[model samples]
Target: MTWLLVIAGAAVGAPLRYLTDRFVQARHDTAFPWGTLTANVLGSLLLGVLTGAATLGDHRLHLLIGTGLCGALTTYSTFSYETLQLVGVGARLYALINLALTLTSGLGAFSVGHAVAQAMST
Candidate 1:
């Protein structure tokens, strides 16, 4: 049952990640992988929230959201690929910016999510 739930969650998460990536790419004219960053940040935030909520003993929820949704949504590979592309294009500064933003914002989202979840519980 747990495995099944995780598989289902992955299915949903992957498509969601792809859609979000496409949407961000389309919206922005830049070649940077804004979509991947967006997904990662959001995924971090969600993980925080889900981790907090897991205190309530909801394995299925964890499997679905953490394993399935966040696992798929947060893409480290894409981030790395985009950074590599930036470097290849001779946009070292741009690549640095992407790296900094991804790290900082991803951390921020996780913090926010943790705080939000804790607050919700209290």
Candidate 2:
């Protein structure tokens, strides 16, 4: 049952990731991967919120949202590859910006999500 639930969540998340990536990438003319960054940060926030909610209730919720949906939605490999591409193409500054913004904002969003969840639970 757990596996089934996770699989279902992934089924939704993976396509959503693809669509979102394409949509965001299309709107921007720059080399920076706004799509991937957006997905990663959103996934991190959602995972943090789900994990926080698990503290107040069911573990299955975390398994479904955090482990399943987020797992498929965010791609560390794509982030790494894009960063490398930026370096290889001489956009070193963009690479660093992407790295810094993604990391900092992801953590910031996650913290906010966790706090929201905690507040809701209390």
Candidate 3:
């Protein structure tokens, strides 16, 4: 049952990740990897919310959304590859910017999500 929940979530998350990446990247003309950043930041926020709401005692929710969905939705490998690609192509500034923005934005989004979830639970 637990595994099934995780599988179901990943089934949705994987395609969603791909579609979202394509959608966001299509609108941008830069090598900044906006699509990857968006997906990661969104995943972090959702994980934070799930963690914050742990008191709700829904283990299935954790396994499904947190483990499966977030695991598939966020792509650290792609982020690293893109960053390295930027550096290899002499776009070091863009690489740095991507790193900085991804870190800060992901953290900020997670914090906000956690706070929101905590408040809602209370």
Candidate 4:
């Protein structure tokens, strides 16, 4: 039953990640991988919320959304690849910017999400 929940969530998250990446990437002309960054940050935010909610005794939600949805939605591999690609192509500055921005924004967004969930539970 738990596995089914995860699978169901992933079924939605994986495609959503792909579509989101494509949509955001399409609008940008730079090679900075806005699409991947956007997906990862969004996933982090959602996972944060789910995690906070889980602390309030919603383990199923955490399993379905956090472990499953976020697992598929966030692309650490792609982020790493893109960063390395930037360095390989002499876009070291962009790589650094991407790294810094993703870390700061991802953590920031997660904090915000967790706060939101906590407040909502209260």
Candidate 5:
């Protein structure tokens, strides 16, 4: 039952990830993977919220949303690929930009989500 729920969530998350990738790629072109970065940041936020809530309530909820959905929605492979591409193209500035943006945004999003969840519980 739990596995089924996770699988379903993954199915949804994967497609959503694909759509986000396509949309961002279309808008920004294939030069950089802005789409993947956005998805990962958003996913990190959602996972933070889910995990915080689960700590206060139910674990299964976190498993389904964070571990399954967000996990599938954010592709580390894409991030790695983009970073390597940046280095390969000798775009040191762009690679650094990507690294800083991804880390900062992801951390910010996670903090916001955790704060929100904590507030909601109180």
Candidate 6:
């Protein structure tokens, strides 16, 4: 059952990530890969909320959202390759900004998500 739920979540997550990436990228002519950044940060935020909610004893929710949804929604490979491409193209500043913003924003979003979940639980 858990595996089935995870598969279902992944089924939704993968394409959602792709579509989200394309949509965001299409909206911006910049080379900053905003799509990937958005997807990753959103994934992180969701996982954090899921984690906070998991304290209520729901393994299936964790597997479905945390492991499945977030796992499929975020892509370390794309992020790494984009960073490499930025470096190769001499857009070192953009690459650094991407890195710093991705890290910082992901962390901040996760923290906010967790806090929201905690508040809701309370």
Clash counts for the predictions, in order? 0, 0, 0, 0, 0, 0
What TM-score do all the candidates reach, one by one? Answer: 0.95, 0.94, 0.95, 0.94, 0.90, 0.95
Write model 2 residue lDDT over 51-111, tens digit each, in one string: 7677676767766777789999988999999999999999999999999998999899889
- List residue ranges in candidate 4 displaced over 4 A: none
lDDT of each: 0.91, 0.88, 0.91, 0.91, 0.83, 0.90
lDDT at residue 90 of model 2 (Cα atoms): 100
> Candidate 2: minimum summed lDDT over ten consecutive residues — where?
54-63
- Model 6 TM-score is 0.95
- Candidate 1 C-alpha lDDT tens digits along 1-122: 79898899999999999999999989998878889999999899999888866677578888888999899999999999999999999989989999999999999998899888888888
lDDT tens string, model 3, 3-32?
A: 998998899888888988999999999878
- Residue lDDT tens for model 5, 1-122: 88876887798889989898788778985567788898888898998788667657676776678768998998888888898899899987888888888889988998899889988988
| Ten contiguous residues minimizing lDDT sum, candidate 5 | 51-60
Give the higher-TM-score candidate: 1 or 5. 1
RMSD of each: 1.0, 1.1, 1.0, 1.1, 1.5, 1.1
Off by over 4 Å in 5: none
Error of 3 at 86 (Å): 0.6
Query: Residue 45 in candidate 2 has what lDDT?
Result: 90
lDDT for model 2, on a 0 to 1 scale? 0.88
lDDT of 1 at 72: 93
Which has the better lDDT: candidate 2, or candidate 6? 6
